[model samples]
Target: MASSRRRPPVEAPIAALRDALARIDANGPVLVAFSGGLDSTVLLHAAADVLGAGEAGSEVESRRSLLAIHVDHGLQAPSADWARHCVGQSDTLGVDCRVVRLEGAPQRGESVESWAREARYAAFAGIAEEVGAAALLTAHHADDQIETFLLRLVRGAGLDGLVSIEPDTMRGGLRVLRPFLGLPRSALERWARSRGLAWIEDPSNRDERLLRNAVRRQLVPVLDRVLPALRQRLPQTLAALREERDRLRELDRRRLETVTEPSRSAPGRAAALSLCAWRRLPAASRAGVLRQWLALHGARMPSRARLAEMLRQLDAPAADGLEIRHDGFVLRRYRGQAMLLPAAERSCEGAASGFCLPLRWVGERRVEVPELAGVLTIERIGQVERVEPVGPVKPVGSPGRPGLAERWLQAPDLELRARSGGERLRMHPGGPHRSLKKLYQERGVPSWARRALPVLWAHGRPVWAAGIGCDADCIVSKGVRYALDWQPLRRSRPASAPERSQH
Candidate 1:
């Protein structure tokens, strides 16, 4: 008979950690997602041992390098106190602790549970990325796993929903780690009690009004009477389903690499791929591939049903062309070609045909494809995009030039505006990657003229001159029946301290 495989040791916090570290292709500097709770307190303590105090501790002391992030979900009455408690714990632990505050009421009618958790997690993620840490450690233990599985079932979630909260997941390059995933909350609580540790007790936890609370206090125990091993079985069940899902997704990806072809040279090739190539996949894979394709280009993913229904229309006729749009996936068939557009570019549509979005916020907009500039409106013959690059900018300011047009353009849309500090560009011909100030001297564009000229950033680099000149190389001739054109503008910058860099 085959021998049974053993579960992970699941104890000794660093033991789980070392194995996780080995699995990654690169060794990530680890950071603990420390909350002042019992679970995370122990997690932080465990992590302190893995990385040395001086080398990994994120403190003002000589023992520095480790980072701890605590998010203040301002939902409870003692939210501030909770944050202070977290900070105090970090100081005691000899790690750098930063408390992030999230404002606004929780999603109404949802008991503030969903919103608070979402906000806290977001703030935690931000701090993790801010530090040079590549991995984030959380203290989600066995009880939480059972709760999660139950919650998913209660909410009518699919098989994927019952899966264990991912112990290691990559979020914007930061891999999330949960050392306590395999351990029970009771174990950690007992350990902390033995160590004589004190923890914050939010009163809401005991209130049975919340479903999670009710589950914690009632349902689980009641079920324990009938099914003793149900809790143990849930996590394993979730793991199996998750493994199956992962394999299927990989198979779909591999199948696509063989069947798909890129034809950028053909007119409307992108559109052609959307209409025909997207339909060739197996019904199960078609929707997934279409969603994947759009997401690759910065578009959002659509619902499975929405994508399937869209392809279902394909049997109608070649002339019937299909346009399916949902969840930011824009599907349009033109000249027997289908195209997917990024939802972030809705404003560009007005410019593409000549229209303007009523401003919700005051800022310049640049369209990189067919190069467009501020208040982009359709123009006769060709569009006009502006470019204005400033000199010496702050990190968050204009990057020395206007936020140029987006980089993913198909031969059009270009514009620029002024921003502050450390802006670098090869503004003048034959110039090294020099500052914008140097470009003005070589071109004699004049100091006063520099602030007035808007920058034309194209493909993350400036490649156009607004008003007086255009990038001599990028212009498409008007003679072509269908040609991409750029209209650029140059303008001065406003003042503001960049509080936080874009995440």
Candidate 2:
């Protein structure tokens, strides 16, 4: 049996910090995320004490050099002054400091805290990249982690969100180190006092209206009194959850790799998935796979409810036109595969594809069609050259067939129009003409994607439809030739097609 005597409070936070630093084992200069607050003031001082004053040069001394970065969100009236104060404090510790002033006001519907955090992290990433720093240090302590955990819990977050904050993690290509995560806020305050450190307090911290502040003030005090062991217990729970989350993520990664098909047009994009295999997965596994797929494409994780809805839609019949739109991406199910496309691309679907606009191709290399949300490129090809079709569209002619004929390419002014209706294209020379709708159907082009496809017309006659390629009449001949290529552009536009261009 162990003795039950209470231990005295630690004299300094330096020991814990040094232990944290040792665990990090970074052999490069570190940038401290200084905010002129008690927590960060203590972090900056301890870092300065351990690392020494000036920049460290040798590999052995690299961990000893420290730099401070202060991001002025300018949301509060005293934000500018706070930045200055941070600079002054850094100077007192003989540490190099940089101050970044953010510009522009938060957009409507955007919260101040969210905007500030985004701006702050972006600034830190930029500075870290510029200085080639290996790590960016923040002063998030145990109390802050508890507050975050509580906030996430109230919001019905899952394991990932519950353990979102970690002591060390990579962000924006740099290691984000939270050395004081194991220490309490009171310990940091005591350390600051012992070192005669002075720091400014942000007035916004006292605002209970903010969720974080409410948790920190009202919820934390109550928890401290009723369940004093929560602080210690929560961290242990988070650590266990983190390990479990990582193990699950690794499993999800392997599953995702087996089912994912890479996009040809967009690098780093997930183009399609095996519907059969996806449907066989358990509901939770399906959701995990979807989350991993979206993350691979650089999309934010949707809420649990939203993810459930997405999975339901993905499992629905193909005729249902199952496409679920989320904050940054759209889960599109077509034919027998699943695709995660940018939300902007969702507008290109449906009845909007019927709207038509015509543009003159004046021998330029590229033409930007804002209405279609894509660009068309005109490139000359040799007689023997064969141009493959883009995306789902198949090649127009037989194997080894050339692209658009040189004569057609030289047409004084060729018209590039959108499919309106009742359009006919001769897919083979001397062959019967077929409706554009039938051709699109035969090519497996999604109905929503047809409107965005460019149709090249020569003398009021349909010569080629992007994706389907040049018509039989426009096949490349034995002379100078060119191929018209269409590439989609990413932009924020209405689902409805733009009004007819005056040109």
TM-score of every prediction relative to native: 0.61, 0.72
lDDT of 1 at 249: 56
Q: Which number leads on TM-score? A: 2
Query: Each candidate: RMSD to true structure?
Result: 14.2, 8.9
Among all windows of 10 consecutive residues in model 2, the one with the lowest summed lDDT is: 494-503
| Segments in model 1 whose C-alpha atoms lie over 4 Å from true places | 1-14, 17-28, 54-64, 103-118, 258-273, 294-338, 351-503
Best by lDDT: 2
For candidate 1, give the lDDT of residue 462. Answer: 50
Inter-residue clash pairs, candidate 2 = 51-64, 350-448, 353-451, 381-481
Across residues 1-503, which tens digit of lDDT does each residue of candidate 2 receive?
A: 88899876544666666666776554667889999999998888778777766234312322456889998877789888898899888887678899999998777877777668767777887777777776777899989899898888888888788885788776535677787888899989988887688999888899898889988999899999999999878888988888888889889989988777643223224457767778777776887788877766556567678888887777776633776786556776666777776665556545345555555455687887766667777776556544444323236333454677756655655677777789887765577788888977775666666666778777667777777677766665466666667776653321111111010
